[model samples]
Target: MDRQEKRAFVAFLAEVFASTSIVIVTENKGLTVADVTELRRRIRATGSTYKVAKNRLVSRALEGTQFDGIAPLLKGPTALSWGADPAAMAKVLVEFAKTNENLVVLGGALGSQTLDASGVKALAELPSLDELRAKLVGMLNTPATRIAGAVQAPAGQLARVFGAYSKSEAA
Candidate 1:
Protein backbone atom coordinates (compact mmCIF):
# COMPACT_ATOMS: atom_id res chain seq x y z
CA MET A 1 0.00 0.00 0.00
CA ASP A 2 1.17 3.47 -0.88
CA ARG A 3 1.42 6.37 1.57
CA GLN A 4 -1.93 7.83 0.45
CA GLU A 5 -3.67 4.44 0.74
CA LYS A 6 -2.18 3.79 4.15
CA ARG A 7 -3.25 7.21 5.40
CA ALA A 8 -6.76 6.71 4.07
CA PHE A 9 -7.00 3.29 5.67
CA VAL A 10 -5.78 4.67 8.99
CA ALA A 11 -8.40 7.42 8.79
CA PHE A 12 -11.10 4.89 7.96
CA LEU A 13 -10.12 2.66 10.86
CA ALA A 14 -10.19 5.66 13.17
CA GLU A 15 -13.71 6.53 12.09
CA VAL A 16 -14.87 2.93 12.50
CA PHE A 17 -13.33 2.74 15.96
CA ALA A 18 -15.16 5.90 17.01
CA SER A 19 -18.54 4.77 15.70
CA THR A 20 -18.46 1.20 16.99
CA SER A 21 -19.51 0.43 20.56
CA ILE A 22 -17.47 -2.75 20.77
CA VAL A 23 -14.61 -4.43 18.95
CA ILE A 24 -13.57 -8.10 19.11
CA VAL A 25 -10.12 -8.96 17.85
CA THR A 26 -9.27 -12.41 16.50
CA GLU A 27 -6.24 -14.23 15.12
CA ASN A 28 -7.44 -15.60 11.81
CA LYS A 29 -4.26 -17.35 10.75
CA GLY A 30 -5.34 -20.59 9.14
CA LEU A 31 -8.84 -19.60 8.06
CA THR A 32 -9.42 -20.22 4.40
CA VAL A 33 -10.81 -17.51 2.18
CA ALA A 34 -14.22 -19.19 2.15
CA ASP A 35 -14.20 -19.50 5.93
CA VAL A 36 -13.30 -15.87 6.34
CA THR A 37 -15.96 -14.83 3.85
CA GLU A 38 -18.63 -16.87 5.63
CA LEU A 39 -17.58 -15.38 8.96
CA ARG A 40 -17.79 -11.90 7.48
CA ARG A 41 -21.26 -12.66 6.12
CA ARG A 42 -22.50 -13.89 9.48
CA ILE A 43 -21.00 -10.84 11.21
CA ARG A 44 -22.53 -8.49 8.65
CA ALA A 45 -25.90 -10.11 9.20
CA THR A 46 -25.65 -8.85 12.77
CA GLY A 47 -24.97 -5.29 11.49
CA SER A 48 -21.24 -5.60 12.02
CA THR A 49 -18.19 -5.80 9.77
CA TYR A 50 -15.06 -7.96 9.99
CA LYS A 51 -11.85 -6.55 8.64
CA VAL A 52 -8.33 -8.00 8.47
CA ALA A 53 -6.07 -5.04 9.00
CA LYS A 54 -2.33 -4.68 9.38
CA ASN A 55 -1.45 -4.61 13.06
CA ARG A 56 0.69 -1.51 12.68
CA LEU A 57 -2.08 0.47 11.04
CA VAL A 58 -4.60 -0.83 13.54
CA SER A 59 -2.32 0.20 16.40
CA ARG A 60 -1.86 3.62 14.83
CA ALA A 61 -5.61 4.08 14.44
CA LEU A 62 -6.22 3.00 18.03
CA GLU A 63 -3.86 5.63 19.37
CA GLY A 64 -5.61 8.16 21.66
CA THR A 65 -8.86 6.20 21.11
CA GLN A 66 -11.10 4.48 23.64
CA PHE A 67 -10.04 1.11 22.21
CA ASP A 68 -6.40 1.58 23.16
CA GLY A 69 -6.68 -1.21 25.71
CA ILE A 70 -6.95 -3.65 22.82
CA ALA A 71 -3.58 -2.55 21.41
CA PRO A 72 -1.71 -5.38 23.13
CA LEU A 73 -3.85 -8.01 21.41
CA LEU A 74 -3.25 -6.44 18.01
CA LYS A 75 -0.26 -8.67 17.45
CA GLY A 76 -0.22 -11.55 14.91
CA PRO A 77 -2.66 -11.93 12.00
CA THR A 78 -5.57 -10.02 13.50
CA ALA A 79 -9.06 -9.59 12.17
CA LEU A 80 -11.40 -7.10 13.81
CA SER A 81 -15.13 -7.59 14.15
CA TRP A 82 -17.01 -4.57 15.44
CA GLY A 83 -20.58 -3.25 15.69
CA ALA A 84 -22.92 -0.92 17.55
CA ASP A 85 -24.28 -3.84 19.55
CA PRO A 86 -21.60 -5.60 21.56
CA ALA A 87 -23.52 -8.72 22.41
CA ALA A 88 -24.68 -9.34 18.88
CA MET A 89 -21.21 -9.14 17.41
CA ALA A 90 -19.73 -11.21 20.20
CA LYS A 91 -22.42 -13.83 19.70
CA VAL A 92 -21.68 -14.11 16.02
CA LEU A 93 -17.93 -14.29 16.52
CA VAL A 94 -18.15 -16.83 19.31
CA GLU A 95 -20.55 -19.01 17.37
CA PHE A 96 -18.31 -18.84 14.36
CA ALA A 97 -15.29 -19.76 16.45
CA LYS A 98 -17.06 -22.79 17.84
CA THR A 99 -17.33 -24.15 14.32
CA ASN A 100 -14.00 -22.83 13.03
CA GLU A 101 -11.08 -23.39 15.34
CA ASN A 102 -8.85 -21.42 13.03
CA LEU A 103 -10.37 -18.19 14.26
CA VAL A 104 -8.85 -17.68 17.70
CA VAL A 105 -10.57 -15.18 19.98
CA LEU A 106 -7.76 -13.02 21.37
CA GLY A 107 -9.75 -10.44 23.35
CA GLY A 108 -11.80 -7.28 22.84
CA ALA A 109 -12.93 -3.90 24.12
CA LEU A 110 -16.23 -2.37 25.13
CA GLY A 111 -15.40 1.32 25.18
CA SER A 112 -12.56 1.70 27.70
CA GLN A 113 -13.13 -1.69 29.30
CA THR A 114 -10.91 -4.50 28.05
CA LEU A 115 -12.22 -8.06 27.80
CA ASP A 116 -10.45 -11.38 27.59
CA ALA A 117 -11.62 -14.29 25.42
CA SER A 118 -13.91 -15.55 28.16
CA GLY A 119 -15.21 -12.07 28.81
CA VAL A 120 -16.16 -11.81 25.17
CA LYS A 121 -17.88 -15.18 25.45
CA ALA A 122 -19.82 -13.97 28.47
CA LEU A 123 -20.97 -10.96 26.53
CA ALA A 124 -22.22 -13.28 23.77
CA GLU A 125 -24.51 -15.00 26.26
CA LEU A 126 -26.28 -11.79 27.26
CA PRO A 127 -29.64 -10.84 25.76
CA SER A 128 -29.30 -8.87 22.57
CA LEU A 129 -30.28 -5.21 22.28
CA ASP A 130 -33.54 -6.04 20.49
CA GLU A 131 -34.41 -8.74 23.01
CA LEU A 132 -33.71 -6.42 25.93
CA ARG A 133 -35.80 -3.69 24.35
CA ALA A 134 -38.72 -6.09 23.83
CA LYS A 135 -38.48 -7.26 27.42
CA LEU A 136 -38.50 -3.68 28.65
CA VAL A 137 -41.56 -2.91 26.53
CA GLY A 138 -43.30 -5.99 27.89
CA MET A 139 -42.50 -4.87 31.41
CA LEU A 140 -43.77 -1.38 30.69
CA ASN A 141 -46.99 -2.68 29.12
CA THR A 142 -47.76 -5.08 31.97
CA PRO A 143 -49.14 -2.41 34.31
CA ALA A 144 -51.38 -0.92 31.64
CA THR A 145 -52.69 -4.35 30.75
CA ARG A 146 -53.47 -5.12 34.40
CA ILE A 147 -55.16 -1.74 34.77
CA ALA A 148 -57.45 -2.44 31.79
CA GLY A 149 -58.36 -5.85 33.11
CA ALA A 150 -59.16 -4.44 36.55
CA VAL A 151 -61.33 -1.71 35.05
CA GLN A 152 -63.50 -4.26 33.17
CA ALA A 153 -63.90 -6.73 36.05
CA PRO A 154 -66.69 -4.86 37.95
CA ALA A 155 -68.89 -4.53 34.87
CA GLY A 156 -68.47 -8.23 34.16
CA GLN A 157 -69.40 -9.14 37.70
CA LEU A 158 -72.52 -6.88 37.60
CA ALA A 159 -73.74 -8.52 34.39
CA ARG A 160 -73.28 -12.01 35.89
CA VAL A 161 -75.32 -10.96 38.95
CA PHE A 162 -78.14 -9.53 36.81
CA GLY A 163 -78.29 -12.72 34.74
CA ALA A 164 -78.59 -14.85 37.90
CA TYR A 165 -81.31 -12.56 39.29
CA SER A 166 -83.31 -12.74 36.04
CA LYS A 167 -83.10 -16.55 36.02
CA SER A 168 -84.34 -16.77 39.61
CA GLU A 169 -87.34 -14.48 38.87
CA ALA A 170 -88.27 -16.51 35.77
CA ALA A 171 -88.13 -19.77 37.73
Candidate 2:
Protein backbone atom coordinates (compact mmCIF):
# COMPACT_ATOMS: atom_id res chain seq x y z
CA MET A 1 0.00 0.00 0.00
CA ASP A 2 1.05 3.62 -0.55
CA ARG A 3 1.87 5.95 2.34
CA GLN A 4 -1.57 7.58 2.33
CA GLU A 5 -3.37 4.25 2.21
CA LYS A 6 -1.25 2.86 5.05
CA ARG A 7 -1.97 5.90 7.19
CA ALA A 8 -5.68 5.57 6.54
CA PHE A 9 -5.59 1.87 7.40
CA VAL A 10 -3.75 2.60 10.62
CA ALA A 11 -6.33 5.22 11.50
CA PHE A 12 -9.10 2.72 10.82
CA LEU A 13 -7.43 0.13 13.05
CA ALA A 14 -7.07 2.68 15.81
CA GLU A 15 -10.77 3.44 15.60
CA VAL A 16 -11.62 -0.28 15.71
CA PHE A 17 -9.37 -0.89 18.71
CA ALA A 18 -10.98 1.97 20.55
CA SER A 19 -14.47 0.57 20.14
CA THR A 20 -14.03 -3.22 20.36
CA SER A 21 -14.29 -5.14 23.62
CA ILE A 22 -12.12 -8.08 22.64
CA VAL A 23 -9.25 -8.58 20.18
CA ILE A 24 -7.97 -12.06 19.38
CA VAL A 25 -4.58 -12.49 17.68
CA THR A 26 -3.99 -15.57 15.58
CA GLU A 27 -1.15 -16.84 13.36
CA ASN A 28 -2.79 -17.57 10.06
CA LYS A 29 0.29 -19.15 8.57
CA GLY A 30 -0.91 -21.23 5.64
CA LEU A 31 -4.65 -20.77 5.33
CA THR A 32 -6.05 -20.79 1.82
CA VAL A 33 -8.39 -18.12 0.52
CA ALA A 34 -11.34 -20.49 0.80
CA ASP A 35 -10.48 -21.25 4.43
CA VAL A 36 -10.22 -17.57 5.23
CA THR A 37 -13.48 -16.84 3.44
CA GLU A 38 -15.23 -19.53 5.45
CA LEU A 39 -13.70 -18.25 8.67
CA ARG A 40 -14.81 -14.73 7.85
CA ARG A 41 -18.30 -15.98 7.12
CA ARG A 42 -18.55 -17.78 10.46
CA ILE A 43 -17.19 -14.78 12.35
CA ARG A 44 -19.44 -12.31 10.51
CA ALA A 45 -22.46 -14.49 11.27
CA THR A 46 -21.85 -13.68 14.94
CA GLY A 47 -21.42 -9.94 14.26
CA SER A 48 -17.65 -10.08 14.47
CA THR A 49 -14.88 -9.07 12.01
CA TYR A 50 -11.62 -10.73 11.03
CA LYS A 51 -8.71 -8.76 9.65
CA VAL A 52 -5.23 -9.52 8.31
CA ALA A 53 -2.88 -6.59 8.72
CA LYS A 54 0.84 -5.98 8.83
CA ASN A 55 2.41 -6.29 12.28
CA ARG A 56 3.84 -2.79 12.03
CA LEU A 57 0.49 -1.31 11.09
CA VAL A 58 -1.26 -3.20 13.90
CA SER A 59 1.36 -2.08 16.40
CA ARG A 60 0.84 1.47 15.23
CA ALA A 61 -2.89 1.01 15.76
CA LEU A 62 -2.28 -0.34 19.27
CA GLU A 63 -0.51 2.81 20.39
CA GLY A 64 -2.17 4.49 23.41
CA THR A 65 -5.06 2.05 23.16
CA GLN A 66 -6.19 -0.37 25.86
CA PHE A 67 -5.33 -3.15 23.41
CA ASP A 68 -1.62 -2.25 23.40
CA GLY A 69 -0.92 -5.23 25.64
CA ILE A 70 -1.56 -7.48 22.63
CA ALA A 71 1.30 -5.94 20.60
CA PRO A 72 3.72 -8.60 21.80
CA LEU A 73 1.43 -11.31 20.47
CA LEU A 74 1.55 -9.91 16.92
CA LYS A 75 4.48 -11.82 15.56
CA GLY A 76 4.56 -13.48 12.10
CA PRO A 77 1.60 -13.51 9.69
CA THR A 78 -0.97 -12.73 12.36
CA ALA A 79 -4.63 -11.91 11.94
CA LEU A 80 -7.09 -10.32 14.33
CA SER A 81 -10.67 -11.16 15.16
CA TRP A 82 -12.73 -8.87 17.33
CA GLY A 83 -16.31 -8.30 18.42
CA ALA A 84 -18.52 -6.86 21.16
CA ASP A 85 -19.14 -10.31 22.65
CA PRO A 86 -15.88 -11.74 23.91
CA ALA A 87 -17.09 -15.29 24.38
CA ALA A 88 -18.60 -15.54 20.92
CA MET A 89 -15.47 -14.19 19.24
CA ALA A 90 -13.16 -16.44 21.22
CA LYS A 91 -15.40 -19.41 20.58
CA VAL A 92 -15.25 -18.88 16.83
CA LEU A 93 -11.46 -18.57 16.76
CA VAL A 94 -10.88 -21.54 19.05
CA GLU A 95 -13.29 -23.73 17.09
CA PHE A 96 -11.82 -22.66 13.77
CA ALA A 97 -8.30 -23.29 15.01
CA LYS A 98 -9.32 -26.77 16.09
CA THR A 99 -10.56 -27.59 12.60
CA ASN A 100 -7.76 -25.82 10.73
CA GLU A 101 -4.30 -26.32 12.16
CA ASN A 102 -2.87 -23.49 10.09
CA LEU A 103 -4.88 -21.00 12.10
CA VAL A 104 -3.05 -20.81 15.44
CA VAL A 105 -4.52 -19.00 18.43
CA LEU A 106 -1.70 -16.85 19.83
CA GLY A 107 -3.50 -14.78 22.48
CA GLY A 108 -5.81 -11.77 22.89
CA ALA A 109 -6.94 -8.82 24.97
CA LEU A 110 -10.34 -8.51 26.63
CA GLY A 111 -10.67 -4.82 27.30
CA SER A 112 -7.60 -4.03 29.38
CA GLN A 113 -6.85 -7.65 30.26
CA THR A 114 -4.42 -9.70 28.19
CA LEU A 115 -5.24 -13.39 27.74
CA ASP A 116 -3.03 -16.32 26.78
CA ALA A 117 -4.15 -18.98 24.31
CA SER A 118 -5.52 -21.13 27.13
CA GLY A 119 -7.37 -18.16 28.52
CA VAL A 120 -8.91 -17.55 25.12
CA LYS A 121 -10.01 -21.19 25.00
CA ALA A 122 -11.57 -20.85 28.46
CA LEU A 123 -13.40 -17.74 27.35
CA ALA A 124 -14.69 -19.70 24.39
CA GLU A 125 -16.18 -22.37 26.66
CA LEU A 126 -18.36 -19.81 28.47
CA PRO A 127 -21.90 -19.30 27.20
CA SER A 128 -22.30 -16.46 24.70
CA LEU A 129 -24.11 -13.22 25.62
CA ASP A 130 -27.22 -14.21 23.69
CA GLU A 131 -27.21 -17.66 25.29
CA LEU A 132 -26.85 -16.17 28.74
CA ARG A 133 -29.68 -13.75 28.05
CA ALA A 134 -31.89 -16.57 26.84
CA LYS A 135 -31.15 -18.56 29.99
CA LEU A 136 -31.96 -15.56 32.14
CA VAL A 137 -35.27 -15.06 30.34
CA GLY A 138 -36.11 -18.73 30.78
CA MET A 139 -35.31 -18.60 34.49
CA LEU A 140 -37.45 -15.52 34.89
CA ASN A 141 -40.37 -16.92 32.90
CA THR A 142 -40.41 -20.27 34.74
CA PRO A 143 -41.35 -18.73 38.11
CA ALA A 144 -44.19 -16.71 36.57
CA THR A 145 -45.54 -19.81 34.83
CA ARG A 146 -45.42 -21.82 38.05
CA ILE A 147 -47.13 -19.00 39.93
CA ALA A 148 -49.92 -18.86 37.36
CA GLY A 149 -50.44 -22.60 37.59
CA ALA A 150 -50.55 -22.46 41.38
CA VAL A 151 -53.01 -19.56 41.30
CA GLN A 152 -55.35 -21.37 38.86
CA ALA A 153 -55.34 -24.77 40.59
CA PRO A 154 -57.65 -23.75 43.49
CA ALA A 155 -60.18 -22.10 41.16
CA GLY A 156 -60.27 -25.16 38.94
CA GLN A 157 -60.89 -27.44 41.92
CA LEU A 158 -63.68 -25.14 43.21
CA ALA A 159 -65.45 -25.25 39.86
CA ARG A 160 -65.28 -29.07 39.83
CA VAL A 161 -66.68 -29.22 43.37
CA PHE A 162 -69.59 -26.88 42.45
CA GLY A 163 -70.41 -29.00 39.41
CA ALA A 164 -70.47 -32.20 41.56
CA TYR A 165 -72.73 -30.53 44.16
CA SER A 166 -75.25 -29.35 41.49
CA LYS A 167 -75.44 -32.85 39.97
CA SER A 168 -76.07 -34.45 43.40
CA GLU A 169 -78.77 -31.85 44.25
CA ALA A 170 -80.55 -32.58 40.96
CA ALA A 171 -80.38 -36.31 41.68
Measured against the true structure, the TM-scores of the candidates, in listed sequence, are 0.95, 0.96
Per-residue accuracy of model 2 over 98-149 as CA lDDT, tens digit each: 9999999999999999999999999999999999999999999999999999
lDDT of 1: 0.94
Q: Which segments of model 1 are wrong by more than 4 Å?
A: none
Give lDDT: candidate 1, residue 40.
Answer: 88
Give candidates' CA RMSD values in order: 1.2, 1.1
For every model shown, the clashing-pair count is: 0, 0
TM-score of 2: 0.96
lDDT by residue (1-171, candidate 1, tens digit) is 999999999999999998888999999999999999899888888899999999999999999999999999988899998988889899999998999999999999998999999999999999999999999999999999999999999999999999999999999
Task: Tell me the lDDT of model 2 at 22.
Answer: 92
Candidate 1: residue pairs that collide: none
lDDT of 1 at 143: 100
Instruction: Report the number of the highest-TM-score candidate.
Output: 2
Error of 1 at 129 (Å): 0.6
